[model samples]
Target: MKPLLSICCTSYNHENYIKETLDGFLMQKTNFPIEILIHDDASTDRSAEIIKEYAQKDGRIITILQTENQYSKKIKPWPNFLFPMAKGKYLALCEGDDYWIDPLKLQKQVDFLETHSDFNICFNASKIYIQDTNTFKEDPFRGKFPEILTIKDLARKNYIRTNTVVMRNNFTLPEWFNQLPFGDWPMYLIMIKDNKVKYIDDVMGVYRIHSEGVWSGKDKAKMIEMTLIGLDMLIKSNILPAHINKILLKRYRKYAFKAQKEKFRGYLKNR
Candidate 1:
């Protein structure tokens, strides 16, 4: 039977947390079948072994265990590998280090998309767990998200957490997407370009923040640099309107000033 939803997960060296992540998927109670497509990007740790253990138990769990790390080869595993295998009406994203808190997450999001034909994407609020501090932070949109979002709203700031997103899976990924160092923001921007985005107020997932994570662990300057490069690529793509470009440019300037301030503070502290 063809699945109505596909849970696309990507991970590397997440042995400690992969079980929790897998359990989250197994606990979901949905009216329709959902396929779990996971790709372990040549983890040096026991992540692949853990994934294999779950795959052996459940027929719905599908996996790709790479001998060589795809990210090291500059390959975007989600688009090139996992997404191609997703045979479902909608795609839900969650990294191996993250876990869904609500079991009805798939049912709620799928119900929304099924009823609202005009909306192409449905995402909910997510809590961020900081491993270093051992603290939980509320999602930015916990109580303050608009009922509906547009491409322009996304351009201003990325409030849609990747783990909570369940989007229509019919569109082809842009060619430049492979070159991006990051994924969520670009994916959301492209997906919402012509379609409407819907936000669910419920907190459905947890985004784990650890030192081993990519964006969260990186230095502020490098994060800003990479984000600017991505925004520039989007602007040059010419898919977005000129007004959107202006909005992005304003954001770019804000990041630049913030980065500069951080640098100045560091210099003063050293002096």
Candidate 2:
């Protein structure tokens, strides 16, 4: 039987946390079948070995264990690998370092999407685990979240937590998506263009903030630069409405100022 949901997970050197993530998938209580599609980007650690052990036990777990590091080779895992193999009507995302807290996470999200045809995506609030500080904080994107989200709202800022997201798998990846340094923000912007996004408000997952995390580890300057580049790509693609573009441009300026501030701070420190 075909699975109704595909949980796409991408990991590299997450040996310490992969088990928790895999267990989260296994714990989901759903009436429909769900396939777990995991891609291990050739970790130097035992992440691949651990994934192999889990795959051996679970028939629902599908894996792509790369021989060489794909990210270093500049491969985009989603479009180039995972998405093509995903055979689900709806796609759920959870990185290997993060885990779903609520066992009913998938069931609740799937139920919402099943009833609400107008909403293209559904995401719940998540708790943030700061690895360095060893503290837990509420997801900043959580409070007062709107029931329906538009492109303009996304363009202004990305409030959706990546691990908390689940969207219909009806869209194609643009060539420009491959060129971007980051993924979630632009992907959400593209997905919500014709469809509305819904917020679930419940805390169903945890987003780990560690030094090795892709975005969490990046300095302010690099982060600002990449954000502006993503906004510029959105503007050039001409996929968004004029009003949304204007909002994006405004955000681009805001990031540009932040980047300049970071540069000045670096100069002062070096001097």
Candidate 3:
């Protein structure tokens, strides 16, 4: 039987936290079947072994143990590897380091998307665990926007937390998606095209902010530059509305200005 939901999890050197991640998936209280498709990008740690152990315990888990690191070679696990294998009506994403706090996280998001046909994506709030400080921070977008969101609203900012999102598996990812440094934001933008986004207020998971994590490790200026590049690709793709194009253009100028100012400040500090 095809699963109602398919979880695509990618792990690399998450030996310390992969067990918690797997437990979060297993503890879900749902009526329908779900498949966990986990890919270990040649982890030089015990992540793969831990994943294998969990797979043995649960029939829902299917894993790929890679001999070579795909990300290092610029291969995205979602579009290229894991997503292709997902055979579910809805798709959920979680990294190895992140864990869902509420077992009903999947159940609630799935319930929302199941009932609401007009919305393609349903996402909720998450707590950010600052590993360096050993503290928890509330999601920045918590209670920030109304229930329903449009392309323009999303264009202004990204409120959807990756781990907290469950989106319809109705569209194929574009080939251009592989060119970006990151995938989640662009994926959300492309997925929400011509569809509304529903934001759930519940806190479902914890996103670890660690120095080893990719995006968390980057400086503000670098992060803005990456965002601009992703938006530039979206603009070239000709998928966004005219108003959104203008919004994106204005966004970059602001981001670019900020990046420039940050760069100038760094230069002065170094001198």
Q: RMSD of each candidate?
A: 1.6, 1.1, 1.2
Model 2 lDDT, residue 184, Cα: 82
What lDDT would each prediction earn against the true structure? 0.89, 0.89, 0.88
Off by over 4 Å in 1: 263-271
Model 3 — which ten-residue stretch has the worst lDDT? 231-240
lDDT of 3 by residue, 112-180 (tens): 888889899998889999988999988777878998998778888888767887999988888878888
- Steric clash count of candidate 2: 0
TM-score, cand. 2 vs. native: 0.97
Model 2 lDDT per residue over 206-234, tens place: 99999899888787788888888888888
lDDT per residue as tens, model 1, 1-271 = 9999999999899998999999999999999999999999999999999999999999999999999988877788888998999999999999999999899999999999999988889998889999888899986567655879888888898887778889999777877888887888878877776778999888889999898997777887788788877877777887677888899889878877887888898899999
Give the clashing pairs for model 3. Answer: none
State the displacement of the C-alpha of residue 13, model 3, in Å, after optimal TM-score superposition.
Answer: 1.1
Q: Where does candidate 2 stray beyond 4 Å?
A: none
- Estimate candidate 1's RMSD in Å: 1.6
Clashing pairs in 2: none
